[model samples]
Target: MAVLTTTVLRLEKSRRTTKKLKDNVVAYGFLAGGLICFGLFSWYPAFRALVLAFQQTNSVDEPTWVGLENFRLLFGDPEFVAAWRNTFYFTGLALVIGFLVPFALAVLLNELRHAKAFFRLAVYLPVMIPPVVTALLWKWFYDPGPGLFNEVLRFLHLPTSDWTNSTNTALISLVLVATWANLGGTVLIYLAALQGIPGELYEAAELDGASVWQRIRHVTIPQTRFVMLMLLLLQIVATMQVFTEPYIMTGGGPEDATITVLYLIYKYAFVYLDYGSACALSAMLLAFLGVFSALYLRLTREAT
Candidate 1:
């Protein structure tokens, strides 16, 4: 009996040691691989972009040092300024509408019981389509006369604007398409978050005579504040890079209204072969995003 007990103890010890060895191997392997990959693909390329921002090149051998000339030129150029304005406009619109709409939709979806899963799937279905495909589909829908959008408006005796070609409506039309593609994923995420909230919290609020607005304001909003902030920051950064829609749909017209920072960089590097200026523009956008991320982190830290 004593021998059997000793044998069992020894086996348990052996198993523990084996587990520790396996864990160590996995942890070290992950750390080493992560560091190597980050250094090779992310860190090195980031520093290289900073270097390229200060140097002049056309994708050939050793770029010449140009000091801050690229940045100077980027700032002084009227087209660059217009792109910057467009970028901010898109960012603001996306941040305001994108985050809020998804949150509101998610809350409404949470109230749904029958076909809840179906509704969730429906909300996220559009995001499954590729952005370029979504852009193309929206472009067809915006066609002046025969497009479904215009046809619907005409059927309703409402005015049908020439969406993508009209200087007045082109940007808004592109925004609507982008929103349709993006809204799904945001809604899904928000739905998950809302469902995670305890029913007890709502019940408690109700017991306290809290109105719907008060419950949302004091409970829902507070509960989801971190997620909301993070998504807002991500949307702002992502929207500032609006490119594919305008590229494939409007070609940065009517009158350059939709030319964004990323579109400008594409024109600089590919069309004009101005590698240095493209890198410089990329660097500026990177700086803005970095500042935004840092500020968001700081705000979240303070809140916590």
Candidate 2:
């Protein structure tokens, strides 16, 4: 009886081991497929760009190595400086306006007990529209004479300003369009994070005589600090690479007030037909973003 029992146990253990191995094999197969796709679509292009950054190539001729020349040219170009300045400025303004607005909207939506679904849908509707279409729609609204905004201003007997045609306001105008189009996703993210907070914390704060602002500062902000930090980093990165709005709306016009690094890259590659310089500019942006990401992760990890 003891021998029979031992044989049965051994058979069961072997079967379980085989099943586990088979499951792992299947999981790893799926993972390998994803990795292969990423390699072909993402990693390969990045590697090619890096290599091309140091080599002069027009895709038809044999490439010649020219280390640092492309970068030197970029540094000497006045447009490069302008592009970086505009990018940094846009990022700062976005942090000031775009960053806070979504959070505020999310909080307000959270507080609403009535028509919650309808409001969320409205907030997120812009996000569902394609970015190109959003740019076109806002472009029409920004038209100087018959634009929707100018018409409304005229109706109110208020002065009409050139929204995208003036150097002073062109960047900010693009920023507004960007904020409205991109904020929906951020609001929804913040809403989800808000919903995950413990209700008990809010109750405790209320019991302690905390006002609405105090509760938000003490309880809500602290609870969502991680999400906020991550979004801040993402927002900075995204704004720095802003291209679509400036590309379609301003065309980097009003004396290049709206030119950004990515738009510059597009000009280099497509308009100027300087693939090497374009790749070099892309490399610079990549390096900056990479360092920023690493530093951010390191700091956040230490904080956590």
lDDT of each: 0.88, 0.95
Q: Itemize residue pairs with steric clashes in candidate 1.
A: none
- Give the residue spans of candidate 1 off by over 4 A: 1-27, 30-34, 60-62
Model 1, 23-141: lDDT tens digits are 99999998998899989999998888889899988966679999999999898888898899888887777766777888999889988879988988898999999888998899989
lDDT of 2 by residue, 1-304 (tens): 9999999999999999999999999999999999999999999999999998998887578889999999999999999999999999999998899999999999999999999999999999999999999999999999998999999999999999999999999999999999999989999999999999999999999999999999999999999999999999999999989999999999998899999999999999999888999999999999999999999989898544
Clashing pairs in 2: none
For candidate 1, report its TM-score: 0.88
- Stretches of candidate 2 above 4 Å error? 1-12
RMSD in Å for candidate 1, one decimal? 3.9
**Predicted structure with the largest TM-score when compared to the true one:** 2
Best by lDDT: 2
